[model samples]
Target: MNQNSKISEDTIDLKELFFSLIAQWKIIALCVILSLICAMLYLRVTSDIYSVDAMVQLEESKGAASAALLGDLSKVTGGFGQKSPVDAEIEILRSRMVLGQVIHNLNLNLIVKDNSSGIMDKFLSQGRSRLTYQHDAVTFTNKQNSLIIKQLTIPEYYSDKPLILEFKDSNHFTFTYKDQVVFNGKLNQKNTSETNKGLWAVDINAQGELLKQSYTVSKLALPTAVKNFNAIYGVSEKGKMTGVIGLSYLGQDPEQITQILNNVLTVYHQQNIERKSLESKQTLVFLEKQLPELRKQLEDSEIKFNQFREKYKTVDVNAESELLLKQNIDLEKLKIELQQKQAELSAKYTNDHPLIRQIDAQISEINKKIADLNNRLTQLPETQRLYLQLYRDVKVNTELYTSLLNSYQQLKIANAGEIGNVRIIDTAVEPVHPIKPKKLIVLILSIFMGGFIGVLIALIRNLFQTGVKDSAQIENEFDLPVYATVPRSPIQETRMSILKKKKSIPILAVKHSDDIAIESLRSIRTAIHFALSSAKNNIIMISGPAPEVGKSFVSTNLATIFAQSNKRVLLIDADMRRGYMHKYFNLEVTPGLSELLSQQVSLEHVLHKTNVENLDVISRGKSPTNPSEMLSSTFFKELLETLSPLYDHIIIDTPPVLAVTDGIIISQYAGVNLMIARYAKSQMKELELSVNRFEQAGVKVNGFILNDIQRSSAGGGYNYAYAYTAQKDN
Candidate 1:
């Protein structure tokens, strides 16, 4: 049973916490509204960025095929058959050099944007251009196609700033800076330079329909252009060992990004081709020099063989000599070819190079072949061996020179028609969707953050609050009985305000008797009646701890409630310094308390009848030179005592006890004293000090009235009243 009760108490506490949060709904509402407004503005001011992608493949097969075309030349140089690492290739794709090429080719260095018409650019739709022009080339421009620039170069000072290139007539053009004309030139032939001394040769075109259209053009620095392009460029390998690469870029314009990506790929491919083409051209030059020398040596060797035969009368050698001669010729030819290859390899690569080492091995093998053929030639007669040796030298030279001749011709053709291995797997196309500024996510986060901020603000305000909360605290802390706890009724005050003109009297009781705040006054009337049952006089002095504690409010309403009960009540504004009862009753203040105390008016003239039934009032009257002295005067006490017998209940509204001795002096004349404490406005220390002041004055404050209770979680002491209302609703 104990455990169950504990759980139930916990649940109730949780319910109270929810009520507390619900009470601050206005704060949360304001936060959400502000956050939504900010989110909408962000959406309006931001622009969408689109992405375009292209695919490329660096063909490893093509690289090997080109190596095969080199044939013997491949063995000479070591550059062939080397495949670039995929990661390295990706870096190269994103390099500043590559990106700069893209920027230059697409004229990305030239920035062209519409001069936004105030804030309308964010809301306008971007569409396809009718025409585009570049490098004096016209494309699609006729009507709405307008003058889109292909290139624009400006001085460094005006890099990112706007420069107006306005069209005056069909062919006339004027470039302006800061609203001042900088240069005047004709269409299709304008200055486009980066220096101020020289004119800029801007490549822009316009057709008959767009002949009068003007545009803005700017030039970005090379470094800035590369950085911007690199920020947008993305390079990635498609799959493992796939040799497939994907390149993408992002921008606000689809047409521009697509062209830019395409141009980037073109530059990358061309760069690769150009790199490979260089090697072939070098090898062709080596081969070209060697080919003519080899041809001359071949012709010289043949002539020498013919001359030797003529000198020796061309002896018919033995069959064995001929067999030995053929073997020697084959060996010698291999040796000469190896030597020539070694020379070529040495010129292109270091001795440590793999291809150069391979050539050295081939030379060693040929030297071994020549040694074996030399031993075979020793078995023949001396004359026959001499003849065989000469014949072998001529035959070997002819074969060696002829083979090199064919290889040289092939290399020449390959160099002339150099083709790289790179292939365009896919070209960039226009993208349909934007890639940035996730709208839904931003809004969601804003909502959450706004709620968080509202809760934080509420907690902070609650922490620093200094006001008294409700009747419970007044009763427990001050040991005073709470006559009534009044909730704020702005509706009743609003109704009265609407009926009255500015500076007119505001009487809540005359117009809004059924208001909830008035109900609290009825309760106070009952409490006051019981408490003052044995009082010396019927006079009730309404005072408070501090100013703005609603002393006048409680007094006026409680007086009206008494009058409604068939008792004649006089509402007296005893606060001569700043009393406003005349405003409440719509009466003149000149003949009231101040006038009465100063002997300026008779009691009959000072007393005023209010619109409320059985209710009369005396205004605080005019300002006095010494309000405290007037309030403490014996005449003021006599005035209250005299009015005590005229009315069934006399309610005198006095100033704050802590602020002055006026309320304390006036309380001595009254039999019953009621202290008004404004809910959430009256401070605990201020009330304590006022209570101490009244005690020191030897005046007994009968009880307290806690008024103007607000409805909120922090106003927990007032929740019981609202809960009762809710139960009534059900």
Candidate 2:
């Protein structure tokens, strides 16, 4: 049972929290409106960023130069070739060597801006590369604020340091660095001068209000520019080992970024070609040096062989000797080719590397074959052997020189035609749209974020309320029964609204007898009847833990309910410190409760009958400084005693028990004391303390009246109303 009750309490608390949010709809709406405005402002002030992209593919060959020299050699050597890796190429694309040239070619390190443009103007310009604004008497063309800078060169010392160019007129300007005048020059011509710091050369043209606006120029250091470029630039391989690189750049200006990327690709391509050309040049130099030696050896060998032929008169008398001479020359040529291959391999790899080892083994094998062929030649006669030796030398030298000459011719042709291994698959173009600050998405998120904050604030406010919403909760917590649940009445609100306009306040019970609040008060009347049967007198004291809990409304309206039942009811506003019961009956405030308590007015004079047939009213006459003292006096108790016998029931409205001792003192004279707690307004702690105060003062609060309740769908709280509609007169 306890667990069930706990669950039920949690459910009611949740319902109360939900209704609290509904009650704070105005605050939530205000927050949402403010958030939307901020969102719009942000979308306005923040500039859009555009992206530009380009792609390049790496060829599979080891470049045109290497292919010319080693294409057939690779086939003979079981296919050994090297291609550049994509990762290395990507790094090269981002290298300072490549990017620096691009920067210099495009003048990317020279930063220029219109110093006259304010932040708002720059933001409103949508991040245009050029400022196009006009001042009085200044001319702005379609090209905008035309500040043309044809050439600008600065030394390393002033890199990234801003220099100001204040225009004297449309065609002339004065340049200054560090607030010191450096030079004065005219437009359309190069201006060169040397200052104490460094050299300066500048050429520019302008067509704006020269005296009104100025321009700033700063040359970034090469390394700084390259680093900045890397920050905005991105490159990667399109796929694994595909040798296809994709490059991209992001910036606020679409045209600038597009141009930057294209320049980068162009520079990278040119560098690749130069690299291949350099390799071919090195190879060509090596071949050129070897060609002279090979040619000399061939000539000398031909001379020796001719001399032997003359001396021995064609000593090759057998086919076996001729075959032996041809075999030795072929083996000797093969060994020379293998040795050349070994030299090239040794440059790239250690001697212990597999390729080098393989070349060495092939050379050793060729040497052994050559040695065998030479041995076979030695078996011939001396004349035939000498003739065969000179014949082998001529054939070997001739073969070696011819092969080297052929390779040299091919390499020269390849070098002239070398276009690198990288090819431009696509070039970057000006982007049509920006990639950032998506308006729709930003607006949507702003709305949701605003609502979230609003709900959070509402929940936080509810969490801090600590107020009682349900009468059952109060009853269970304090172990005190509630006499009646007075629902919020539209008629009472109308009365208050009218009073705020300085009109006479209408009595809810008499003017709107069938109102739901009156119906609840009739229930209170019934509860009071039973309580009075065992009380010391017929008087009832109504007060609350705090002010503005509608204790006066309950007191006034319940008295009217009693009067309507043919019982004489006397309603007294006993709170001498700020009471308004006189406004309800349209009576004078003087000669009432404060007067009667002070003995300034007699009982008969203070007793004034109201418009209601069986009800009389005693207003709180003139606020007094000693209200607590007056209420605790014997005269106040005697006044209640005097009025008790004259009416069937007497109800006294008192000040907040927690605010003053007036209520506690007044409760001592009443037959029953009741605390009025406004739903969702009066805190539980205050009510408990108020009741404890009464108990400590030797007065027991008979019960509580839960007042001004706003009925909700939550099932625990109570509110009285007409269950059926009233039938209208036909």
Most accurate candidate by TM-score = 2
> Please, what are the lDDT tens digits per residue for candidate 1 over residues 201-242?
565566665555566766788888888778868899999888
- In candidate 1, residue 623 scores what lDDT? 77
- The Cα local distance difference test for each model comes to 0.70, 0.78
lDDT value for candidate 2? 0.78
For model 1 the TM-score comes to 0.78
- TM-score (all chains, Cα) for each model: 0.78, 0.80
Q: What clash count does candidate 1 reach?
A: 7
Model 2 over residues 399-434: C-alpha lDDT tens digits? 889988888899899999998888999999999998
| Model 2 pairs in collision | none
